[model samples]
Target: MSIPVGDVTGVEFDRNTAFLRHTFLGLFFLLLSLVLTVGIVAAVYLGQVETRTDIAFAGFFGLFAVGGWNVTYGLLSRSNREVIDVYITTEERTHVLCGELADAEFVDACAELVDSDLPTTNRNPKLEAELE
Candidate 1:
C-alpha cells in the first residue's frame, strides 16, 4: 500500500519484534543441551552405570546445539516487513527510501491535513433543541 508522502519530523523503525520466534526457540534448544550435558557429567561422576538413555540424550544435546546455532543466524538475517520509511520535505520535492517503493510525487493542489490538529467544537444541546 502506498501512503501519501507527508512532512515528518521524526522517524523510528525496527527490523524485528522483541519476541522473535526463532530466537526463543534457539535459546530453548541451547539451554536444553546444557542441561543434558550437565546431567550426563554428574551421572558419570557419581559412578552410575552408563545406560543407553544417557547416550541418546548426549546425541540429542549435540543436535540441539547445531540446530540452535543455525536458527540464531537465520533470525539475525531475517527481513522485517513491518519496517516503515519516513519522509519529510520542506519544498515541492520529497525523497523516500521505502525498499522497493521510492520517489512518490504529489501535486501542489493537495494540502496534507494533520488530523491531530483538527479543532473539536463543543455542541450545546439546548441551543440545538430551540432551533429545531
Candidate 2:
C-alpha cells in the first residue's frame, strides 16, 4: 500500500471559506472558549487539580478550550490565502492527501513547480499554480 515518494505526479486542493468571517456563531465559540480556559486556570491556581482524576478533567477542559480558540481564529481571520485541503496525485494516478502546509510556502512552491519533476531538486511536491 506504499506509494514511493518519487511516484507522486501532481497536487490538487479543495477549499471552503464559509466560516472565514466574524459571524455571530463564530463569536459565540470565541466567548465560550474564554470561560472554559478561565475556569481551568482558576482551578489550577486554587490547587483544585491535585488529584490525578481532577488533573485529567482539567486537561480535558484545556483541550476543548484550545480547539475552540482555533475555530475562533479561523472564523475571525480574513486571510484569503488559507487553504482547507491539499493533496498529491501519484504517478499511478491515485490521490494521496498532503496535510496543510504553511499556505504561502505551499502556494509559492507550487507556483514555482511550473512543470517540474515529481521531486523538484528541493523535493517540494509539485502543486498546481492555483488551489481549487
Candidate 3:
C-alpha cells in the first residue's frame, strides 16, 4: 500500500538558491556596466569618438540602474519565499513529491503516516552492506 511519508518545508533551500542566482546575475551585469563605462571614458579621453559618447553613456547608466534594482529586489525577496518537499512511502520503495506548505492537512497526514511507520528496515543490499 502507498502512504504519505512526510513533508519538509522551509525558505532556506529555495531562498538561498534564488539569492545566489540573482546575486550572480546582478554582479555580472554590474561588472559589465562598469567595464562599458570605463571603456567609454577612456575612448572619450583619447578623443577616439565624439558623437557616440552620449549613446555610450546612456547605455552605461541604464545597465547600472537595472542591475542595482535587480540586486536590491532579489535580496529583499529572498527571505519571503518558501519551498516544500513531500515524500510518500510504499511497501516497495519511497517516492518524493512536492507541494506548498500551506496545505496543513496534507502535511499532517504525511507526517502521521511516516511516524506510524517509524524505524523502517533497509531492504536494499547495498545499503544493508554499508550498515554492516
Candidate 4:
C-alpha cells in the first residue's frame, strides 16, 4: 500500500507517532572499525609486533582501513532530505523507503478523503469529483 503523504492524523511533526525508532547502526560500525585500526597501530608502535609472523596484522589493518574509508564515503555522500518510510508491522517488520513522493499532493487529498467523518463527498459532488 502507498504511504499516505502529509499528516494522516493531522499531528505536528514533534507529536507524530509514526516514527517508532531512530537508527545509528552505521555509526556503531564506523566506531568499531576505528577502534580496531587504532589497536593495530598501537601494537606496532609499542613493539608488541616484531617477528616476521606479525606480518599478518598488515593484512588485517589494510582490511579494516578500507572498510572505514567505505563508511566515511557513504556518510559524506548521503543526501540531506526528509525521507518517508512505508512499513508493515509483523514478527519481523518490513520497511520500504518512499522517496520523492514528498512532491505528490494527490496522496494527501486521498488520505484526507479517507479520514473525513462528515458526508462532504456525498453532500458536495463537485469537491469530491475534483479530489478523485
Best by lDDT: 2
| Candidate 2 lDDT, 19-131, residue by residue in tens | 24557767999999999999999999998889899999999999999999998887777643334354566756755433233566655554544355554222322333352
Q: Cα RMSDs of all predictions?
A: 14.7, 10.1, 9.7, 11.1
Model 1 scores a TM of 0.30
Per-model TM-score on C-alpha atoms: 0.30, 0.45, 0.37, 0.44
Error of 4 at 101 (Å): 3.3
Ten contiguous residues minimizing lDDT sum, candidate 1: 106-115
Q: Cα deviation in Å at residue 44, candidate 4? A: 1.4
123, model 3: CA deviation in Å?
20
Model 2, residue 28: displacement in angstroms?
Answer: 0.6
lDDT of 4 at 35: 79
Off by over 4 Å in 3: 1-51, 74-79, 87-95, 118-132
Q: Write the per-residue lDDT of candidate 4 for residues 1-132, one digit (tens) a residue.
A: 543433233211111223322236456657777877888788888988877778687666768877875775566456544333333222333333243324356336434544564222222332243334
Q: Ranking under lDDT, best-scoring first?
A: 2, 4, 3, 1
What is the per-residue lDDT of model 1 for residues 64-126, given as tens digits with 9 covering 90 to 100? Answer: 656655665666556533222323332455344332111123211111222233221213332
Which residue runs of candidate 2 sit more than 4 Å off their true CA positions?
A: 1-22, 79-132
Please give the lDDT score for candidate 3: 0.47
Candidate with more favorable, higher lDDT: 1 or 4:
4
| Winner by TM-score between candidate 3 and candidate 2 | 2
Backbone clashes under 3 angstroms, per model? 0, 0, 0, 0
Which structure is stronger by TM-score: 1 or 3? Answer: 3
lDDT of 3 at 114: 41
TM-score leaderboard ranking: 2, 4, 3, 1
Model 4: pairs clashing at backbone N, Cα or C within 3 Å: none
